[model samples]
Target: MSVIAVNDGTFVSELEGKGVTLVEFGAVWCPPCKVLLPILETLSEEYAEGLRVLKVDCDESPVTASRYGIMSMPTVIVFKNGEPLEKLVGLRPKSAYTNVLGKINAEAARL
Candidate 1:
């Protein structure tokens, strides 16, 4: 699946009933956020079956951002069953993300 744009209104529901979700809290004006977009898009497609990737503009979705305690731009939070599982701040290597997803998948399988 392609990257999904999420707002305050759709945040909660989007996370609900999902297996695993990676939410990027960022703003368009932020350079690092811009740099991270394409990486997330590619991951979204590569992990299509096991993960769901969503983006939330911090400037446009303040409520969702605050709820997630996003003090910095480009904070990526991974969620499972609507609960946050892991959080990564700033720009990270693609392998870093895949590593987290791998752990989540393993945990899910064990459960």
Candidate 2:
């Protein structure tokens, strides 16, 4: 499944649901952000059962971006139980994300 695109008005509500969420704060003009899109898409499908991947156009959702302290484009914030769990800036290998997901899953299992 494709990553859901969210604006400031819909951002919080989208993340209000249960489970893990990876939200990318980026803009259309960012090159690295464009490159990260496919990676996120693949992840959204691979973790469809346990994860929700979302994208926020920084230009369009400045409020939500600032709320999360997004200082740069292509910042990915991982949320657990509707709270910020981790933040990964810039583009990263798929394994980087999988590693975090693994940890989240392990923690979830422990709980």
Off by over 4 Å in 1: none
- lDDT by residue (1-111, candidate 1, tens digit) is 988999999999998979899999999899998989899999999987788999999899999999879998889999998999999999888889999999999988897
After TM-score superposition, the amount by which residue 105's alpha carbon in candidate 2 deviates from its true location, in angstroms, is: 0.6
For candidate 2, the lDDT comes to: 0.91
- How large is the C-alpha RMSD of every model relative to the true structure? 0.8, 0.8
lDDT of 1 at 20: 92
Q: Output the lDDT of residue 61, model 1.
A: 92
| Whole-model lDDT values for every prediction | 0.91, 0.91
Task: List the candidate 2 regions with Cα displacement exceeding 4 Å.
Answer: none
Number of clashes found in candidate 1: 0
